[model samples]
Target chain A: MSDLASKSVTPGRDASASAATGYRPSRTLPIVAEIRRQASRRRTQLALGFMVLLPLIILVAFEFGGGNGDDDSNGGGAFSSLVDLATSGGLNFALFCLAVSAGFLLVVVFALFAGDTVASEASWGSLRYLLAIPVPRARLLAVKLVVALGYAFLALFLLAGTGLLVGTLRYGWHPLGSTIAAQIPPGQGVLRLLGILAYLAVILLVVAGLAFLLSVLTDAALGAVGGAVLLWILSSILDQITALGSIRNALPTHYSDAWMGLLSTPVQTEDLAKGAISAIIYAVIFWGVAFFRFTRKDITS
Target chain B: MYKRQLQIVVATSDQAFLTPAAPATYTVAIDGQLTLPTLVGTPIASPAAIYWYVLGALLAVVLLGLAVLLLVRRARRRRRVTAVNAELAETPLVVTGLRKAYKDGFVAVEEIGFTVERGQVVGLLGPNGAGKTTTLRVLMGLTTPTAGEIHVFGHRLVPGAQILSRVGALVEGPGFLPHLTGHQNLEAYWRATGRPWEDARFDEALEIAGLGSSVHRRTKNYSHGMRQRLAIAQAMLGLPELLVLDEPTDGLDPPQIAEMRRVLQRYATDGRAVLVSSHLLAEVEQTCTHAVVVNKGRIVASGPVGDIVGESPSVTIDVTDVPAATEILTGLGVRSVTPDGATGLIVDMNGTPRAELVASLVRAGVGVDRVVPRRRLEDAFLALVGDNSRGSGDR
Candidate 1:
């Protein structure tokens, strides 16, 4: 101990020699690393697990409950009609799953993944370390955003893919009985499912963007996810108010079901185009705010 | 023939050449060297000219905005460069007039100025809420300072600055992914740093941690002391030049604390620097080569450990019949007398000689068992921050 203390405070070495060798800020927090980190979390596993399980649960219910055998063509609108045709084929069941889950289930899942990405790190007290690692703030956010979106897209695919598999085994591989088309060929039906999946991925960007914004704004993971989901629900509620007239058209959820146009014979493009455009615009705005806020945030957490 | 290479530039001032009445093309010559088309295209009508004028104006506005943005960025970069170049010598860390005020106008660190030289373990000592942590936060770029500048390795520090790669820090507390194993957490952190795996000095850090096989166990089940040790090891990763740890010994047992003291001392060797903040005086006295004492966002005293400890002119006296010894010492007009232990009495020497006090004690029939100078950092710390110690506000 005395020998250690006897050493003078001026050990001879170059000042710059202590800088850690081979560090480049741009290379920090790569997208693959971020994906691996997030993927390892239990929440991510559970979310994707639930998505795969939901369709099986629905299939089991259909098998036991027998679909309420009232074949009188009740005309319960487009959604119920789609549900009625779910057992007809694998394609129809996949479409039914997409239609049912697109509104809320997919929204919540996407919001949870994107919202929890940053806020969870903050709550865990690791964000400051990342920032101090000198991971350029913009690169950090960009990588996390990419990974979150990737996971959200995976969740969508799992839901529809599981539904198709289960439905094919339970029923059979038959053409879809769409509302407008007399019978959609199995090949065309699968193509249309892919198209609908692409559209859902695009439309859900607004939820992901809003959740990402809230995640940057708050350290509480639940608050970020729940706040975004609540705001979406509020927009959905406000979209239901017909008395609001043309103003309701500006609502984020107004064109949420626009992918239904894909089920028509000629595949109506009008509402689908409007939905894609509006969703992109809203997503850009929310993402812009998130980037602007995050770059300047103090990150006290 | 224009001698100046017949520059056919579209001059905005030549309005007549662009008039609708003007011919589609015209030729001009100067000095008979060359002939060039003065008006190369059909003249634009008024409405078309207005449209072109609007487009030109929009393009000009965009160009001007881009130029302004570039200028601002250049100015910021220039300021940083100037700050870096102005340094006389490159120290591990140098902070000047650093101040930070929260959004609600509560000033956490009012004005702090200090330097951590290489090969020195400098301790930032203060009472609770005396702005020790706040100062460290600003230095780490975790919190922006409302005023002042921080320079590391002759580079002005900013959020996500590349110069931070040279420093390792564990500010406020340890932060780790609870779900990951200790080794995995350290690996993830180092990977996030984008530094080479070999530079992480994993074997050395893990040895310091002494977690043994527990390093492979998930962090969630680990105790607080385990996490603290892991965090300190994390900071030591890459063996950065400047290590800043806040309360590095908060959760350690006595043995671990003792080990930590040696680690910090050895780490600070070879031209590396360390800055640790702790309210524990003994920890700083034992570990740090130099100390900076802060009280209420201000430096009260700062110097080598011996100098600061020497400021308190006091002595601890071991005596039989402490009451009689105290009476003798007080009657001698020393500033104050306080009990140390059962047989120890601490007397503020007040510039009075130890021999004089002892002589009086013996004359009064009080057995003077022993007399030793009070050199504990605690005495110096209290002497420096004693008056307004309780007034140190919340951070």
Candidate 2:
């Protein structure tokens, strides 16, 4: 190799040919590689498998239990409460499913993706090698966050699809019921559902950002994941502590259920917008602190 | 004269083994210098807290026992021999006063200084927890040094696009996605670098790594040696100006270690520098032209391997009249002479070259058949690193 060519192949440049054309490689590839790595792991496969099979298990249980014809209190039947919840414009069954899944499984999924991302590399003694490639610390954290969010979105979408399909087939397509204190016409139900998905994406992004920040702070994969989960659980607990009052609104987890407004009659969007803004704010704060600390921290261990 | 003898003793293992009685100690007299043998004394005190102290002492003893066992095994498997040739060129990469401390106040590296020059493969020789890897990481810019600076090719190392571009490194164990094939791993690295995939270069790298047909196989299936070689190949790609390899031959067998030496030597011939850190002193002697011996996060000795190993004025004479030659050489005040059974004589001289000694023996009516120089970098490294009780001596 000539001196010129050797000089061009400097570390940290990502070695993309477009660099010669004044185009830098996107900082996203490393993040994608990490995601690909995690997805290939047996643990991730098992986790995803369990998630995909969850709704089916629920459907089977409800189907078998509802067959007894125990009660007919509402217009539908024993399962009618579920269907009414879906159509009653207040905490509909579908919206309730989104909130529950997002609050529970989505937190694990985000922690699974983000919290273990950098820590796993460190534990495997691969972080030094990756960093030796001269990758900037900031870029490294960015890639990690992107990968975590990618997994979070995929998990959320899978849960939503499974819940929607089973609920529609089992309870009939009567449109989504509301969870917030608003009403919506049937014509606007589809729009509201789309809006709810977008809002959930923001909420999950915040979760992923928190997990990623924790990953930077710890070398143990379990520590990062467990710490982030603990933080989320703690925040949820504190949010429910009535004495915390308005202070709960400041917790990022508080807005996780903001999509509840999408199911409300007349579509109460105020809370949803507040939730979206809060998610974005939390994401920025979490990611910014992670990047700053990671970039400045000395990786000795 | 004695310094010269020390060098020769270090140079030839054959002489050291043959004579077995040459004085192992030599003193140097320097003007205005205090020549004190500093023996650190422990405090004389009554043994208080007997149970806890006993437990601590027992733990220390057990740990020390394990360490000695490991060292003995390592030394037996790999006999370190340092070969210094004047034929090689010298250009140094200087690292000065490097230090790194974690947030919890654990110091990983402290005030370490060393220089590795051109045409020389230098090894950072130390045991685990010796901060060898941390120094390499800082050199590679993977970790920022809390203090001190590094100059590679006269360019001060600062985190930037330009500085990182010229350096290639493999720190710690090989880093590759397990599911990806060796080729795919390289491809991913290439793509991540934003470089257009070049099939020819990729193939060449795999070939150089000796992965050959197995390059298409998933890396998870690769043996430890193969993974290490692949890591080396990745560092060698794009012909980096300076290659910093950490435990490059860690898991390799004897044959693989030899192959690694050949590969690194090939890299050195390109006028590029290679800095390899390994606990295997013998391997370092074979591969590196320079050495920076570190223990406890600081460099004890850093220089051309030849200079550090110095020259030993010992000459081995393989001749039929071994007794006659030994007597003849000793008659001239060459007190360090020993007869080798029936065939050869070993003579240790003060600052005398092999040629001069052979001529002197021949002139004194002694037949001289063969004369050769000795190589001994291993002894020097052991002497520099010393026993484990030396607390942070290098730093």
lDDT per residue (tens digit) for residues B1-395 in model 2:
01112222223345646765766755654569545567875645533335334545654765686479557735642331121222221232568799988778888887798776655688887767779988877776667778997766445664433245456788877877677788877766655554445522665567668877898899889999889888877876656667888998888888878877877776765456789998766777778888887777777777777776665566567875776776767767774886644776656776656677778777877666677554445434444555445533344
lDDT of 1 by residue, B77-175 (tens): 456544453452468888899998888988888899988887899999988888998888877777788999888887778876777888888987888
* Residue runs of model 1 more than 4 Å from their true location after superposition: A1-19, A67-75, B1-83, B86-89, B316-350, B362-372, B376-380, B383-395
lDDT of 2 by residue, A183-268 (tens): 44445765776677777787776767788888888888898888888888998899888898899899888867656555545445
Separate DockQ for every predicted complex = 0.20, 0.07
Model 2, residue A33: C-alpha shift (Å): 5.0
Model 2 DockQ, alpha carbons vs. true complex? 0.07
Model 1 per-residue lDDT tens digits across residues A199-291: 899889999999999999999999999999999999999999899999988888998998888888766666666676677768768876887
Candidate 2, residue A188: CA error in Å?
1.3
lDDT of 1 at B376: 53
